[model samples]
Target chain A: MIDTLIWLVALPLASALATQLLPRYATAIVISTAIATSINAAALLYAVATHGVMLYQIGGWTAGLGIALRADGLSALLLMMAAIVLLASSIYASAYFNDNPLRRRFWPLWLLLWCSLNALLLSGDLFNLYVTLELLGLSAVALASLGGKTAALQAALRYLLVGLLGSMLFLAGVTLIYAGYGTLDLATLSRVVAAGPIAWSALALMTVGLLLKTALFPLHFWLPPAHGSAPAPVSAVLSALVVKATFYLVMRLWLDIFSEVVTPQAASIPGVLGAAAVLWGSWQALRAERLKLLAAYSTVAQLGYLFLFFPLLQALPAGAARDAAMGGLVILALTHGLAKSGLFLAIGIIQQRSGHDTIRDLDGTAQRLPATTFAIALSGIALIGLPPSGAFLGKWHLLAAAFSAGQWLWVVVIMIGTLLAAAYTFRVLGHAFGQQPYPRHPVTIAAEEWPALILSAFATIGLGLAGAPVWQLLKVSL
Target chain B: MLTAHWLYGLSGCLIMTFGLRAVLLNDSLLQRIIALNVMGTGVFMILITIAYRGPDAAPDPIPHALVLTGIVVAVSATALALTLIRRLTEEQDND
Candidate 1:
């Protein structure tokens, strides 16, 4: 058990370091490590599934002095989602960047980013999470600029500055928490935390910092540019994995550690911002000229669904309803992770074929590659929360919880968001099929397309068909 | 004696505000990076203040350790940001 926990993080770090030292075998090392890490992640998920929450104290020092790694049901689910998305991304990238000179440099940083993500998800300490966040931020920024275009470099710069600012605010909040409670461990802090000025200030600072990092709504200005300009694999990881990590931390802080410190008014703030994000983000997405920009805006819109659960959760009393709402939020996150990564990967193929991602120009290219179009169509269905998709199931619970709690305003918001999502998604797909029938020969990039197809299938049919296991996992705890 | 903690805390907050304002208001990328580092320094200062105990008691090592890690992170981020900024400038120059 402990070995799985250790290797889940260690394998990536080892491969990252090894890649830096022996640059020739970077691809071989990264691919093998990605496969190994995903296996370990699966093992960790299985362990958490059967045994419940697993905690490992480092160096035999429990609680106060030593760091702790924990794998609750939520962490396990996130680990699995990350593993699948990253493995697919690695495979797609191997083919996508087969001849690019920057391919070797990409491997090591990507591994480091993966390592930090696993560490952040498993971390039980607040300070340790801060370290992991910084590590993730740096590597992600480096990868974002790997394309080295003026636009990519500029976007990476902006992302870096904002990310550092966010980390600083988070650290300041941690300082206050330590001042008020004298502990930096999340589990310990949760026990001792209470509603007071210090706690409120600390929570507010941390939440705002996380919101900025998550790029929720008004703070999302930096995301579209960065995600749109990066090489597609980097964009996929950033959109699907990086932002979600911060959001996960915010959810963890609110729902688990700082639940005592939460107030109705404070919770509504995010709910309000989430609604705006849904509306504005979807509108922008509908008007986006470039397919990559559309995907980025869709990410902004999709993240709003996660936050919309907050108000409903706060309004519902402790029972099946609140649990379902929380479960819905997790399902939404997982689905978005899978679906978004697949969408970006498909877009990468389209861009490579067409030499650009403008939705208008992609018509001829898309007509040529049916597999990529199908990947987009499949993921787009999930993204739009159409019937029989995991997002549909998630939104069903969200709407149920909202209606039961008498929160009809949120229902209207979700409906509007869904309509906008459908419009924008099909707008791109509408361009894919031209009046002229292009020859339907097998795509040369079939290897790259398969992972995306597999991922979209999981996002749509796989999760949609299998709800009992996910519901069972969400039942473990907050 | 009572006012010392509040004094330190308020000053830390003020410095943070200044840094944040500078980061948001500055047009120059270099100034924003500088502002970010300053903000990090303010946070580190707050952390150090939080670690302070009574004159006789041993200060908590945890916050100190946290501050050290924060410093390392801050330095690495600064270096990366500066490098990106340099690369952008060079790309523009070549153009």
Candidate 2:
């Protein structure tokens, strides 16, 4: 299991270097790395499922001295989701970047991004988390600008600045944690962190920094352009996995480290912002003129749903109820990661085929591309929380929790957000029924279409039917 | 109560506030980027202050290591931001 953790990071890091050195075989290298990492992620998940939480301390030193890699059920699940999404997207990217000179650079940066995501998820020390966060930010920004367009470059620059600011604030928070507790290890800090000035201030600084990076509500202004303007595969992962990584850190801090320190009122702050994000982001998506822009705005709204879980989880006593709500939150996040990536890859296909992603102009193109359109529809169903989708189950738990907690306002917010999501989703699907003649065949390009189709189907059908294990996995911590 | 530690810590906070203010309010891209770097320096200062001990005592080594790693990250980020700015300027010139 420890070897699994080491290989999870080392494989991608080595592959990234190999791709840089051998650019001609970058595609082949990335494919093999993706397969290898996926296998490792599965092994980690299986090991954790069978043996509970696994911890690896580097150099045989204690937690506070040497870096530690910890994977409980939650991190393992997220790691698996990331591996699955990256593998699917890598397949799409291979075909998407075919015949383009950009593929040479894309492979290295893509692998670096994967390495950072794995490192960040497994990092047990606060300082190590900061380093991984910086790596993730830099690699994401570099990838975002690979489109070489003015919009892409400008958005990538803004993203870099915001990311830097967020990391600086996060580092300051870490400094305070170390100053007060004399330890950078999360487990040690969680045991010692109590309610006080140092704890409160560090919590505030870190949450604000993370919220900025996660782009919650008002801080979300930088996201749409950055995610929308990036090339297809880059946008897919940026929207799917990158933002979620920071949110995962925030969840770790709030629910795990600062569980006793954080007040319900404080938790409500993100909940309220999340409520606003849902309404505002969905509205923006409905009003967005382009396909990619709508998807980006929808991302902002989808993340808001994740934030809504914090308060509910805070209010619920630590019992089966809280565990269920936690499971729902993870499931929703996983569903969004899969569904959003699928939607982006599908849109990428449309963009490549039609040379534009204007929502109104997608009428004939949607019908002409049957498989991609089906992928979009499947993702749209998951996004709207329709039945037999993981999001439906997620939102079901959310509503039940809200009702139990007597939080009527969140219920209202979820209802309105769902309605708005339906409006926007159907708005896109409406294009598929246009007058243009439908393609005779279902699958056009198997390499590209299959990835998106498989991802969307998993979000809707695969996880939806088998989501009970999610709650069980949530129970398997050290 | 009034020691070098308090003074340095307070100054670090003040510097970080100023850099954050400029980064938020300033319109020039280069200025914002520089302001971000300034903010990072303030953070490093705070970390260094945290590492400080009495004149006779050995200081903590963790914050020193964190600061060094942070400096490397900040330098690389600044380089990336500047390269991006140059590219944007080149695009403008072409336009």
Candidate 3:
């Protein structure tokens, strides 16, 4: 089972290396790797489900001496989400970049990015996480620059600088932890950690570093341009997987490793920024002119919702209520990962057809591509937290938790964000339904269209309707 | 010995603060990239300092290994950032 974890990371890495040697077969190699890893992810999920939390110590070494790979319920769920989203993105990229010159470069870098993501998700060691983060950051920047346009290059550079800075700060925090505790393993740290200046300082550094990487609220200035200007598939992964990875780290550090050091006052800081992000990001999304920019801003708002879980967790005593809030957060994250990637892919198709992604100008193209438009609508429903979508249920539980805890301020924030999301989502839909005099040219829907449609449908109808299993998955005792 | 550790830690923090300030304040891409590397090096020095002990004691190998890995990652990032910067300059020149 643990050997599969090694292969899950190594397969894509080896394929990435192979793609460089045989660029002609790079597409085939990448697609096969994606499929293979999806199976591997499923197998890992099943193994964890049946066997409970499994920790694979690298090289058969014991604690405090060597690294380990941990797969708990949360890690397994995230791995499966990543596998699904990346598989869909990979399939879409094959058709989306069919005739493009940059496809060769994209396949290799994307595989490397995928490899880093799996490695990051599985890594239980702090230093290993840092290494994987560096790998993920570099590959992500490289993929963003595959567009070869000035805007793309500029966005990539800015992203690289921000990411490097975040990594350095995070490493500094890790240094402080190691200096104080003499261990880099999270499990060991959690057991040994105590409330102290060193621990508090380390938590602050790591939290801020991760917030920057996650692009939560004020640090999110770099996200829109980077996500909006990248190629469609790159944008999908950036919004769906890469940003979420950092947030996942923040949660791990706060709730698990640094739980001993984290005070309620300190926890409320993210909660406050989260509220700000909800209002500010939604306003930005509502005002965005470009379709992709709107989606990018929506990501910021959705990430804000993820942070809202923190205060609820802090407020509620450790029991069913806290677990329910955590489950809601997970559900929202998983749903958003699916829906946002679908939204981006749909926008990509729209851009290809219309030759631009200016939301108001997409009337004719949107009319021509019904499947893609429907994809957007379905994802839009999920994003807006409408009935029968995963986000709807997730936010319901979150709001319930918030209300019960007497945190009415968060209730108001959620209400405002939902309305704003609806406004922005429908803004594109309104434009899509416009009447145009130009004769309808039949648009050939490519193979790429299906992945977005399927994923969005799963998010909207599937997860919304049958979220019990997800809640069940989350119920596995820690 | 305790004074030496404090001095090294304090200096590391100062170097990091300076590097971070430089990175944030600079408008030039090269300066920002260089500043980021400087910031990373400061962190590495701190890790090394933490690993240091008395003259007779063997230094902890963990931070040494970590610093080595950090250097590789930092170098790769710097190289990639430089390449991107060069491309940006070329595109601007063409424009």
Number of the predicted model whose DockQ against the real structure is largest:
3
What DockQ does each candidate score versus the true complex, computed on alpha carbons? 0.88, 0.85, 0.92
Candidate 2: stretches off by over 4 Å? none
lDDT of 3 by residue, A314-408 (tens): 88888888878888888899899999999999999988877899987777655578778889999999999998999998999899899878889
Best by TM-score: 2
Judged by DockQ cut-offs, the docking class of candidate 2 is: high
Fnat of candidate 3, please? 0.93
Candidate 1 vs candidate 2: which has greater TM-score? 2
Candidate 1 wrong stretches, greater than 4 Å: A438-440, B1-7, B54-56
Count of clashes in candidate 3: 0
| TM-score between candidate 1 and the true structure | 0.98
Ranking by DockQ: 3, 1, 2
Summarize candidate 1's per-residue lDDT along A1-478 as a digit string, tens digits. Answer: 6678778888899999999999898888988998898889889878877888888888889865888888888988999999999999999999999989898889999999999999999999888888998999999999999966888898999999888888888887887887888787888888899999999999989888889999999999999999999999999999999999999999999888988778778788888899999999999999999999999999999998889888788888888878888888898899999999999999999888878889987665556888888899999999999877899989999899989989888898899999999999888888887776766574658778998888998999988889558878866653
lDDT of 1 at A363: 67
* A369 Cα displacement, candidate 3 (Å): 0.2
Ranking by lDDT: 2, 3, 1
| Candidate 2 displacement at residue B24 in angstroms | 0.8
